[model samples]
Target: MPRSKRDKKVSLTKTDRKGLAWKQRIIDDIRFCVEKYPNIFVFQVQNMRNNLLKDLRQEWKKNSRFIFGKNRIMQIGLGRTKAEETETDLHKLSKRLTGQVGLLFTEKTKKEVLEWAENYWAVEYARSGFVATKTVTLPAGPLEEFTHSMEPHLRSLGLPTKLEKGVVTIYSDYTVCEEGKVLTPEQARILKLLGDPMAKFRLTMKCSWTKKDGFELHVEDSVDDNQSDSAMEEEPEDDDEKEEMEGDDE
Candidate 1:
């Protein structure tokens, strides 16, 4: 039997489906963090190393939480222009999440986090096309580690090499790269071959936010390293003296 028009259910239209489902999920995640942690920090990374990051998560599992991926969604979750949306100061962190940045919700104080970021470092092979931080020079001597067959490949990297009785020998000191110079394919390959790792992995506490401090950016400024930049300007004092007396005493 056909139902009456008033009895029919209202169907959702395209406008109802305008937003992705995950956006709400991200918002909920951000809200949960606000309820759970006292302070939050943001970190920007030059590259991603899954194993190392996983280890860090395990180590800080007791006191910290790491949120990565879907940065834009998370940014919107925190609030963009105003704090009224989230009803918290989390919005202040949105501006600094422009690049590959992640959220760190932690019970630990800001000083502890910043110290770890400044001191904790890892060394890894420098990728091709990155600038060489230092010069890689191979002295004129017998390269007993490499066989004679590798002579051609070594010379291809611009090293003056010759095979002497089935051994690769460098005729003179060969400079593979210069400091502050963009490394070429050959230079990177030779550096790795020589087991000279130049790249140092480091993290910076780009910024942080909290209830008492509001928002702070860890930039080089007049403030000392021991101080946090989150202190906002003092709010106007309430002129209660000019107001008429009201309710009863407690």
Candidate 2:
């Protein structure tokens, strides 16, 4: 009994296949950077913002390259062990790629990169669940800043806001957020409306690898030697770990 053409099932899972291709492309690109650039620095981003990073990439497009992707894929790119590492002591650098980090392959000197990163930071709105940096209290009074129509939306966000005499007003002293506290969705929204941003997107230099210096840790506690040294298994891409190729040759 031959199955009918319409009865045959077609596989729907191409995510894994696409992820592998993306990973391999990253690995190849990393290796290529190793050949093209003389130095590589692994840096951690405090608050990830694609727009800020994209701007930096454009500015350094000629002299530097940045790669942001899954840690496991990046580890495989530079190799996870001495025997497999693409460059000398890069395995040590690979171990430090443990958090929300990215690689900067560049021709710039180590001092230049360190100085730039130390002073570079951007302030942006904090999202829900972010720890508040400072307490923001709105005194009970007319919120003349907002339009009367915005009273309902403000009230829905847990604000004691109302329309009074064609003005939005708060009945009582409202604490939008408190320092050392995790923000709720409503609190975060209110803070944004009030133009109070809590998140500081900054890059901290973790470590750097060069042919002359090998692996050097710029920041203390960048990588724990006691942590697992086992090679990271290959992982499929997700929304967070999507491929980011900036200033790559390709």
User: Which segments of model 1 are wrong by more than 4 Å?
Assistant: 1-28, 46-48, 83-85, 147-163, 220-250
**Among all candidates shown, the one with the greatest lDDT:** 2
What are the lDDT scores of the predictions, listed in order?
Answer: 0.69, 0.84
How does model 1 fare in lDDT? 0.69
Tens digits of per-residue lDDT, candidate 2, 116-198, equal 99999999999898999899999999999899889899999999988888999999998888999999999989988998888
Clashes of each: 0, 0
- Which candidate has the highest TM-score of all? 2
TM-scores across all candidates? 0.66, 0.85
Residue lDDT tens for model 1, 147-186? 8888999898888999888889999988889999998888
